[model samples]
Target: MENKTRTLYMIPYIGWIILFVVAPIALVVYYSFFDIHGNFTVGNYGKFFTPVYLKMAISSFWYAFLITIISLAAAYPTAYLLTKTKHKQLWLLLIIVPSWVNLLLKAYAFIGIFGAHGAANQFLDIIGIGTKQLLFTDFSFVFVSVYIFIPFMILPIFNALDNLNPSLLDATKDLGASKWTTFRRVILPLTLNGVKSGIQVVFIPSLSLFMLTRLIAGNRVITLGTAIEQHFLVTQDWGMGSTIAVFLIIAMFLIMALTGFRRRGA
Candidate 1:
């Protein structure tokens, strides 16, 4: 009866996944085989392999790598500090509140801050560094992405640290291990799963950031997500867009495979 009840409970969730996730992927795969005129063709896939699309893919990966690395660097230290705080939960909440704001709203807020006569430039002027163009630059895009993703990167690491056994640290101290040695040999390796989870969340989404690339980057950084949006919305090339989506899906699967945790006792 418990087994029956478990299966019954899973029915709705399984149905929802098939209806939403599986159906959309199936549609995209189907559309990828057809041309703009609805005629069946494989030219879309061929075009994706060409230099133009290849370069865009490389650029997108590079940006995602930078965003992930920067977010990890900032987040790890913040998470460690939070773990040491008396009111760590409250501090963590404060850190995450910015992420709860809508992405578009945050993007617009950055635009104002980074604009020509904005706070950033004004501060520069006051500091003897004259105002310079800050908006719509690579720096702005990377900064904003890191700001948005840092919370995600922090949460998992925080959980890992919070759950860590304090006795391990005591043992390391008793063994005459220095702080750096303890961290390098023990702390980091144990928390590696959390780091992996953080990278999975940050890097995958960064690869497909269309709105920020448009607003903060001023269309200068053309990531795969932007290309997909342009093909579908502007050019009305559904086939090509679907082809890109298929490849993006493949890339996502590859990332998941690379980052996925090992099964216990496997």
Candidate 2:
């Protein structure tokens, strides 16, 4: 009876996944292999391997990789300190509060901060420094991406660090391990799952970030996400758009696989 009840409770969740997740993916797959006229073709998939499309895909991966690395680097230390802080909850609340703002609004806010006469350049001018171009550059795009995604990375690492058994650290110290040695051998491995989770959360979204690329980078950065949007909305080429979406999904899965995210006992 208990098993039956549990299964019954899961029915709605399973149905929801099938209806929303599975159905959309299935549609994408279908459209990827068909043209607008419903004729079967491999041309859409073939376009992805062409030099221009391939370059865009690589650029997208590179941008996402940079964002993930920077976010992790910043988040790991902050999360570690958060674990040791007296007012951890307060600090965490502050860290996540910015994420509550609308993403477009946040991007727009950075526009003013990074504009030529914006706060950053104005402050520099006040200090006898000449104004420099800050907006519509790769740096601005990456900075905004890292700022937006850092919270995602930090929360997972904080959770992992907070849940660590303190006795294990004491044991490592008792064994004459140096602080660096303890972290290298024990703390890092233990918190790796959190790191992996954070990477997935940040890296995946960073790959197909269209809005920020347009608003912050001023379309100077062309990524796979931008390609998809152009194909679907501007060109009205649903087949090509679906093909790019499929490729993006595959790339994400490959990243997860390479990270050992699916390894047994991970």
Candidate 3:
């Protein structure tokens, strides 16, 4: 009776949640089963498993995975260094500043840097080494994604390290453990949950990148996001678009759930 009463009292908030979240997802599911002709079928999804779609999915994951790895490697050491610094506020400010810039603008800014005959090429010319094309390659997309998402990876691990008790490290050292040993055994385990969360943050958004790939990656690169956008907006194949979208959402949700479960288990 008490639970029912509480549930009833929360109806307004629940309605808002359903309105903003659940309803959109339900619509996506409904749309995915229908083709351009609006007939009920899984034909769109069946076509999705073909060699082309499979290749797109694989490439998307491959690029996203590389970004996640690069984000972790870059963020982890930078975060650890922040832990030892007295000027922690400055580091925090620097990390938060880039996040204020719009995503599209950041992607556009990289266009001028990575484009053929852009700044990189000019620098190469000055050095007499010639220029290399960066556009549309895995290197261009994955590298820019990593750069953008480094902050996401940094913040979680920083929080974990900041919340750590200073005495714990001191105690480990006093007990004859080397710095690396103490880090490996105690600090690393304590921070694993945060790193896991950060990895998910970096990984999931990288999967759905559209404008960045469209810009810095240009014509030669296509991912699941690009495919969905093209199908819906250009090709007028909403069924195929919805199917790809549904798969992306499901994959993201499953990853989040697994990350949560891993944290709880730890």
Please report, in order, the local distance difference test score of every candidate based on alpha carbons: 0.93, 0.93, 0.87
The TM-score values for the models, in the order shown, are 0.96, 0.96, 0.92
Candidate order by lDDT, decreasing, is: 2, 1, 3
Give the higher-lDDT candidate: 1 or 3. Answer: 1
Candidate 2 local lDDT, residue 120:
92
Cα deviation of 114, candidate 2, in Å: 0.5
lDDT of 1 at 60: 92
| TM-score between model 2 and native | 0.96
lDDT of 2: 0.93
lDDT of 1 by residue, 124-146 (tens): 99999999988888999999999
Q: Which digits, one per residue and each the tens of the lDDT, describe model 2 over residues 1-266? A: 99999999999999999999999999999999987777899999888899999999999999999999999999999999998999999999999999999999999999999998899999999999889888999999999999999999999999999999999999999999999999998899899989998999999999999999899999999999999999889988899999999999998889888765576364
Best by TM-score: 1
Off by over 4 Å in 3: 1-9, 126-128, 263-266
